[model samples]
Target chain A: MPQGQPLTVPNDGLTTKARRNAPLLAVHTGPGKGKSTAAFGMALRAWNQGFDIAVFQFVKSAKWKVGEESAFRELGKLHDEHGVGGPVQWHKMGSGWSWTRKQGSEVDHAETARDGWAEISRRIAEERHDFYVLDEFTYPLKWGWISVHEVVEVLGNRGGNQHVVITGRDAPQELIEAADLVTEMTKVKHPMDAGRKGQRGIEW
Target chain B: MPQGQPLTVPNDGLTTKARRNAPLLAVHTGPGKGKSTAAFGMALRAWNQGFDIAVFQFVKSAKWKVGEESAFRELGKLHDEHGVGGPVQWHKMGSGWSWTRKQGSEVDHAETARDGWAEISRRIAEERHDFYVLDEFTYPLKWGWISVHEVVEVLGNRGGNQHVVITGRDAPQELIEAADLVTEMTKVKHPMDAGRKGQRGIEW
Candidate 1:
């Protein structure tokens, strides 16, 4: 599609400006790379536009220091100190959210994921952030760690101008049906095909 | 692929560490969104790891104030002031590079694209930036504005550890063959499919 131009216009009663400004529920999924990275890129754009941003990583290990985490933390710090951008919150689901602690209990991936979804659902109901990134969230829905039906219902009825993006592989048909936009990152080729491993600042 | 792990190990004489650290030529193409966005996301990671970044926009108009452009400018300024991250240089081809000015001539997109490729080629030869983003570059190759053969040659033979990412749809087969990683952004669904137009922040 050409920049800023839609191929067709629906007669959905909404004006062009209203339809254009409607918040998006986007999903990035497939068996390729860059799904989370692309969502983070959109987060950067949202932050630049003064939109409050929140990211919840559902599947990645909390100990994994993905490069984007540090970069976003730095961006958050920049916003706090210099007021150059909007606020940011990053949370790793099973490790307990950064905002709340599950004190002495041993980590349970499924329970933690459920709790994380609960928190996110609460936030969506309250319109807590302008932009929400459910990073790798598809895994939870796919594995039955969370209810896809409930998640879709929440997202479809999310209030205000809140925009949400979910990223992972094998996104559920229900979620895809509900999303306003969806992109599948198909792997045409990979270094792994040539027996090459991932590297710092690139894969992470 | 799992983090930092390859499915197979090549018997190509190089050590695993050496192969892991080898620079990449990644292509993000196909008929969907977020190709350039994902590349910029990689740029963000690269910058966090102290990689100098140079982004060349080949198809976007110079007048387009992409949110990432302003955000990177702020990041570049932050680097200048506090030494927080790596430096960044954002360039829009046809309007002339930020480092150099072309005076007294009307813009010819094809010639300007060729000039942009020439500049990128020279930079690659000199090992200028640690990370290079040739945004929307495939169009020039597809349209015969710049040569795909020459691009593949320059990228394949580039010296040092410069990682280059090319983004746009309809990537040439030769270029894809030479790339270390290639992701095709397939459009599963889009807001435009329902007649919704692109919005600011998300589209730009």
Candidate 2:
């Protein structure tokens, strides 16, 4: 037998129908990039294959942004066409960086963060869908909204048959280490940093 | 003003925005139903109006099941056509299901449930998507995989500006009570119970 290859046994205890468990895959990439985009593509691919799927968008509010929200709406349309039923759920943080700037330090971003994490914890324990995607997850840890240890504990103990993908910049080293698969996206070049504003339908 | 209507006094020391937070909606329907489908439609409507959106799919495996996976795979294509970027993301649960027939015990189911919830909790805490959906969340709880209290904690504490949705039959009483909106799908009729299996391009 080749090195590192499993040795076949004619009468081993294992049956021909026995199946092996699948490991988790995590996608972590840098800022101003397509980490979430790539993750979403993978999700659509999995969903079309008849697997049950669930999605949680952390830290974001419903306020209209230019690019991200519009594309999500399109995904929702696709979900509808496919007749996969579930509420496209959201847990929004009341505070935003811009809003906080205008309102001063009185804004309570911490409460928003706390509230968001609580819901997240519950969903993980419940294990409703076969696949989950965590978008922009790194920020909570980066912003000190939640602890890395807590995140690790939860992920380490997750159920079998569940696949997860996480996207963000500045992912914690612990998270990267815990993940079975990690992909980093480097921004080679972009039109935004050159001082040209984002264009509608292209950037937004 | 009507009895239930608020009595205003020159703004009452509060801004109009403060008086009403954005509407947060959640929909959890019955088994083998279309909760995600309805939520997705709402997301599309919100997106077309120029809202910023985000998406996360929970408990998904890499194995393709139907056409939905293909649609998620084409998320980048959708983004390219719509000129939206950054908001759409996806995550998959790398682990597959915990089989009851194989394990042959409730304890195995319970363990799987616990693991599943842990993953869901981790993702919910980390990401920041505007429209969040927990598909088939009630399954583990129903099957005795996890406790209901844990599920409640997450749902109750999520941030504002997120319209959250959850789907499944026999949702806990607390979830319904806490929700701003709730819809229970009573199956008046279903094709599967009538001896017809799910039809592709329609059932999925």
Leading candidate by TM-score: 1
Model 1 interface root-mean-square deviation = 1.5
Candidate 2 deviant stretches above 4 angstroms: A1-25, A60-91, A94-107, B1-69, B72-204
State the fnat of candidate 1 relative to the true structure.
Answer: 0.74
Q: A10-74 in candidate 1: lDDT tens per residue?
A: 87899999998899999999998889889999999998888899999885465443688888888
In candidate 1, stretches whose alpha carbon ends up further than 4 angstroms from where it belongs are A63-65, A103-105, B63-65, B103-105
Write the residue-wise lDDT of candidate 2 on B92-144 in tens digits.
33343332233313335456556656765665565455555565566666766
How would you class the docking of model 1?
medium
lDDT of 1 at B152: 92
Q: TM-score for each prediction?
A: 0.96, 0.43
For residue A197, model 1's alpha carbon misses the true position, in angstroms, by 1.7
